[model samples]
Target chain A: MNKLAAKYLRPELVPTKACQGCAIGAIENWLLQAIDEMELKQEDVIFGAGIGCVGRQTFATWGGDNFGATHGRALAVATGLKVARPDKKILLVVGDGDAASIGASHLIHAARRNVGVTVICEDNMGYESTGGQFSPTTPAGYVTNSSPYGMAEQSFDPCDVVIAAGATFVAETTAVQWRQTVKVVKLAMQNDGFSFVHIRFPCVQNFGASALGSRDPLVSMEWIYDHTKGKTDDGAETDFAWETGIKHDASNSRPEYSKVLRDLNARVRADMAAGS
Target chain B: MALSEELVAPWAEWQESYQDGQRLLEAGTYALTEGAVAAGLGVFAGYPITPATDIAEYMSKRLPQIDGYYLQAEDELAGMHMCAGASLGGQKAMTATSGPGYTLMHDAYGWAIVNEIPVVVVDAMRVGPVSGITGAPGQGEFYVSRYCSHGGNIETIVLSPNSVQETFWLTIDAFNLAERFRTVVTILTDQVVADMFEDLFLPGDYGALSDIVVPRRHNLTMPFFPADSSEIDLPPNVIGEGTGVCVSPYTHTEEGYDIEEMEAQWSQTFRLINKIRHHKDEILRYEAVGLDDAEVIAVAYGATARTVKTAVLEARRQGVKAGFLRLISLWPFPDELFERDQPYLVCELNYDGQLVREVMRAAPDKNRVHFMGKSGEMHTVAEVCEALEGVAKHQKMPQQPYIWTEVR
Candidate 1:
């Protein structure tokens, strides 16, 4: 195993259950690299995972304290963990279905509360773990098991949703752009309040064949890069690119949920002491 | 100070916040909410549901006063998930909801059961097949509390409170039981009990709350919900406590790793079920009134039990031999408490008899069992007396059939 992988992952649970050439593996690698770059202790981080292909990576690889939350409840779980232990860093890892579909309310409210937690949503277009069902993020006219004829609804842009919901920092990246993914994750971790990173990638085993018209994982990666907008390391804008940069970065003036709670508690204690 | 004193000093400070003296007449829901605070509730997450909304509203105002956390989740599903998360974080966590919202919480409740995370879910039931009546009372969720969430053979610790005072004490008991069993403990109250106003006595002297045993970091490396029966009593380790324990909703092995083999599944499922079932004697609790020499016994629970008690007294005044058995612990179904030879009239607020079904199964004579139930309305004292009179006269009224109607 590589040094970065060995440092961030549990040794016995290495070589994840993710499918061959699946972006989830690459995304996990980038996340570990980001943690390594930040020099954060694995034990100090609490990882919350929702139910999906991306959620499976939490226990399968991440060496932190793992909370396998119910479908679409990873952020809510992370919120609780963050509040309970404000000194620790909480990271929520969920799939597109978890963040934008059933658990969409959690994502919006977590951002609205400005809780101190980082959310990383692995957007593979559809629910890949459940046999290629159409997710809320599956684009219009995309065909999958559930949307055989093609999805009628327009796809959701989670980055824009989180930004509107009052996230302190929001960004978009892809699995193929490992360095950019790491950079975005590092930025999110450094942010004071709710941070959201929407990582769009293809499900090589499921959605790749049906929706993206590609069976090869490399072809899927190429399709993701070619179809979306991206920015080079030097920060030059390009059309139809992967759009790999921070979309929103709010000032740290807004109080976090835990800090506000602590302040209120301190005030209450003071009132009690004054005996008024 | 010693090491143990250092560990307990924070709890001591929290206990000092407990107020003494009567807080005045309030709704049963207030008792529950205040009782949760008195029980050292560290976190409360809930969504707005009629009859149960006051519990959340009260917590929102009170929890922050003591540095406790209160979050109004987007919905009941998220609320329940938050409660599970908070509980797993070494806090006594709870959530409140009515029937419709309770239905949305089945998935998370099941997750808590499988992961063995302790949480208290307060269900103030209204009439329901789905949003049947928001204003009316019903004991319709009795079965749902026990058998909720899809899949096979799951048992839970369910406590039903029949009075405003019982609501307070039972809320504390609910948390205690949840902590003890390392499972979900549900406090099932109805709209009548939850919304009814009464003078609740706050104890003059408050004692230190019962300590919830959080597993030490050294012991957390083992399976959270150990498959071995002897080691099943250990509480789950809190996350971010330097206990890198992995908790999953799937059937998992001793090390908290997901496993799909039949033996592993059987061991895990068996442990989850038997952990509560084998301890039924400790879990099952009920109050029997005048069952000793009575010819007829009326079995009831929650708000309906209060009316049943009144009717029993009225029946005795009329020279009828009717007694009441008020069920406090609805699940683990107190089968041994039932007298097989005596005829029973199971009364509830729901049209379809949910609790009576359990009565029939537990009683030796199923033929002698009778059900008097109505939906979207509480049972009148006169109606219960009439049922007792009819049962005493040996004239069995036909079982009330469930009537389903759409309400806009």
Candidate 2:
């Protein structure tokens, strides 16, 4: 076993169901690495997963508490968990279909409310788990099982949506850029208010073979990085248009939902005592 | 840690501050919301739907005062999911909605049931196949609450309240049952019961709050469900409680991990049903008036029961042998209460009969079961009396099957 795997991964739960060359495995390992680097206890963190290929990452051998939410509703579940246990850090992991399609409303509203939770969207372009159907994030003219004649609508940019919806921190990276993905994920965990990290990855078995005209997954991943506009090296000013680094970072003075609730209760108690 | 004394002390004080001579008059929605607070509700999330909106509005203003959390979710689907999430985090959470919103919540309701997460859902019935009427009273959701979502071999606890006072007490009972069984408890009320104003007796004395029982975590070896019905009373380990537990909606083994084998699935399904089914005697509740010696009996619940009571009295005055059976617990279908010899006239405020179907199934003779119902309108006492008169005159009212069509 590798050194990191020996320390962090559950030995009995290895050999996952993810397809060969799928980025989900690598992305999950990177997240665990980040968690370990931060020295956060497993008991202090909870993972909420939406349904999809990426959602299966909730079973990562790290042995932390995991909640499997319904399709496109992980953010709502995370919001509730954050309110119930504000001391615990909440992280939601979802795919494109779970985030941009059925769960779009939850994503926007959670950002608008500025709830203290981090959301990680692993975009594989289409719905790979349901056999490669067209999704909201499938690029226009991309061929899929549902859209044999190519997608008719434009793909949605979730980072822009969350930033516009008042997310305190927003970042976009890809599985190929492992270091950058780790850095941003760590940053999101450290941030206070609502944080979003959109990671564009490749589905080896489905999207790679169907849309990219290639059976090899690495080829499809390289095509994605070459086409998207982002910095390939370190020490560059991150642009807002599909930039690999932090897209929007602002100091939010607005109170988080849980903190506001706590303060309000304290104030109300004080008022009652004074009146008495 | 237990809930801080300061957090719950004000609510206790508020309950005690009611004057001894003053009678509190409030809507049924207010009573239901206050009852949730009294039950130690830690989180309340919901969307605004007709007749049910008052419950959410009242909770929005009151939950914060008690150091509890309230969220106006994007929709009923999200609201139910939030309630499940909060419940899994060791909080007693609840949500309220009407028919349309209740339909949207079916998926999450199933999630809570399968995972054994305790949450309360209050469905204030309004008319519907599709947004039928905002103010119309209907019991169309009676069966839907019992067999909701798309699955087989599923069971849940459902309660019905006919008046504002009952609405308050039943809400508390719903929470208690939810905690005890580790299942989702639904409080089924209708538009008439939710909106009607009445004199509510506010109790100056408060009972000790029921303790929130969280399951002990066995580290990585924690099993969410017990091996057999013998251990069914144990609560499942919650997330973020140092359990390192994984909760899934798919058929799972005792360790809370997903399993695909049929034996694993059957074991879990059987336990889910038997947990509530075996305890039917403890869960069943109803009120019987004069059924002992009567030749004819009327079965009713929710708002329609009020009319049934008066109609039964009128039938007796006119020398008709009629009695009333008012149901409090709708699900687990109190089948034992159905007498074999007496004929039954089931009344509800829906186009097609919902509860009458259950009555017929439980009855020894389906031929003796009759239904009187109307859409978007309550059955008048006179209408019920006329039905009782027909039974007295040896007339037969055939059973009506539930059908879907536009409500006119």
Candidate 3:
């Protein structure tokens, strides 16, 4: 294990169950870099995860207090946990299916309430854990196992959705952009209200095989790099490009959801004392 | 009519310990809310639904006053998950909803149970397979509460409150059990009990009743799960306590990490099932009247118990030996109560006959157990009395309007 990972991750669970050549572990290392840069202890942060590849691989690897919530409900749990322990940083690592599909409502509502938590939505574009089914974040015209012909539906950006729902901080990065990913993650953790960091990574085993027509890690990495730069290796324009970087930066602009409750409690208790 | 009553519950002693309380008239929802507050509830997450909506309203106003949180979730699924999350973060959390919302909570409910997160869920049932009569009462979730989450290798604690006063004490009891068992405790109340105004006694100072309320304790050491043991009162694992505890929906190890091994599965299931199974006596609570010489007994729970108790008294007035058995604790089904070799008329608020099936499985003779199912409304005292009289005189229940007795 690397130095930063050894500092924050469980030694026994260091080699995550993520597939060989998959970027889940790499993205997790970037997250650890951010946490280490902030000088946060394992105890100072609580890791929450949703069900899917991202959730399973990253769940208990955080050698800290952590929870693997039911599919798509990690944000709901984070909202409650934030209310109970607002002093601690609650970070949720979830998949595209968890954040944008099954758990979309919770993601939207948590952002709307500006709950004090940082969400790392690790989008692999497909349900790679369940054998590469098409997800809501799967790019249009992409061929997943579930969408042999093509993903008929247009893909929606979770970053856009969270921004629309009033997320305090929103950022998007890809697997190849490790420096930007770590920097933005650090900024996301600093936000007192809801912070959503969308990191799209490659699934070499399934998504690479079906979408990129090869299971080679190099092929998938190069494809993601091309999409990030919006150009191919030969300088031709790519079909789609992810407009990466910090999309929104209204950090700590409003009181957090739990703070609102606490303030109400203070006011109500004051009135109760006055009435007595 | 005078009836010999035997009330069996821990709160009977709890009531004696805290006698210096104020008596006031309130709705069951108010008692439930105050009961949760008195039990050191730190968070209540819920969605507004009929009959149970008043609980959300009461929680919203009451929680803020006492340094507790009331989160109005986007839906019932989110509400229950939030409660589970709060409980994981070392708070005594609760959520209230009706049938439709309760069904939506199954996913999070399973997660909480498997992880042994302490939470209380109030399913104030309105009639439904899917949002039936919203304002009417029904005991439709009798079996659903036991198999609340999918999977058979688990046990649940479910209680039913017949009146407003009981709802208060029972809510506290539910919280205590949730802490002791380190699992979800469901209060399967109904519309009538949740909405009706009745006399409720609330202790003057909740802080003074520390002996009665189970305080939330955190497990800060290793072996977060202890899946091999059936022991009670092991402090629940908290997320922000730096315990490094791992909680998930999968079968887990003593250290709380998920494992797919069959040995791990067996050990976890043993702890989940046997914890309550071996300590059934601690979880059992019921009220019985005149079972010694009674020829037939009227069995019921929740709102249906209200009229059934009256009917049993009226049966005695009509020169028939009829007994009354009102179940307060519904799950870890008190099969011991049905040991008496006599006819049991299982009265419930659903025509689909849920409790009757359990009564059949428990009673000494399956043939002796009869169903008296009614839906959308409470059974009138007259109807229950007639059913008791008919069962006493004849071998079966007499044909009655809107009452379905066919259990097959």
Query: Candidate 1: which stretches are off by over 4 Å?
Result: A228-240, B1-23, B208-219, B230-232, B398-408
Top lDDT prediction, candidate number:
3
Give a tens-digit lDDT track for model 2, residues A1-276: 555556655566664568888877777778778887888877877877888887875553556788778788888888888888888888888899888889999999998888888888889889998899888877788788888899898887899999999898899887778888888888888877898999887576777777777869767766666645543335343232355789988635577777877888788777877994
Q: Candidates 1 and 2: which is better by DockQ?
A: 2
DockQ rank, highest first?
3, 2, 1
Question: Which candidate has the highest TM-score of all?
Answer: 3
Q: Which stretches of candidate 2 lie above 4 Å from their native place?
A: A3-9, A228-242, A251-253, B1-22, B207-221, B230-232, B397-408
DockQ top scorer: 3
lDDT of 3 by residue, B147-194 (tens): 998878999999999999999999999999999999999999999999
In candidate 1, which residue pairs clash?
A: A228-A240, A228-A241, A229-A241, A229-A242, A229-A243, A230-A241, A230-A242, A230-A243
True contacts kept of 3: 0.93
Query: Over all chains combined, what TM-score does candidate 2 have?
Result: 0.91
Cα misplacement distance, residue B267 of candidate 1 (Å):
0.9
Worst 10 residues of 1 chain B by lDDT: B1-10
> Deviation in angstroms for A128 in model 3?
0.5
Worst 10 residues of 3 chain B by lDDT: B1-10
Rate residue B179 of model 3 by lDDT.
98
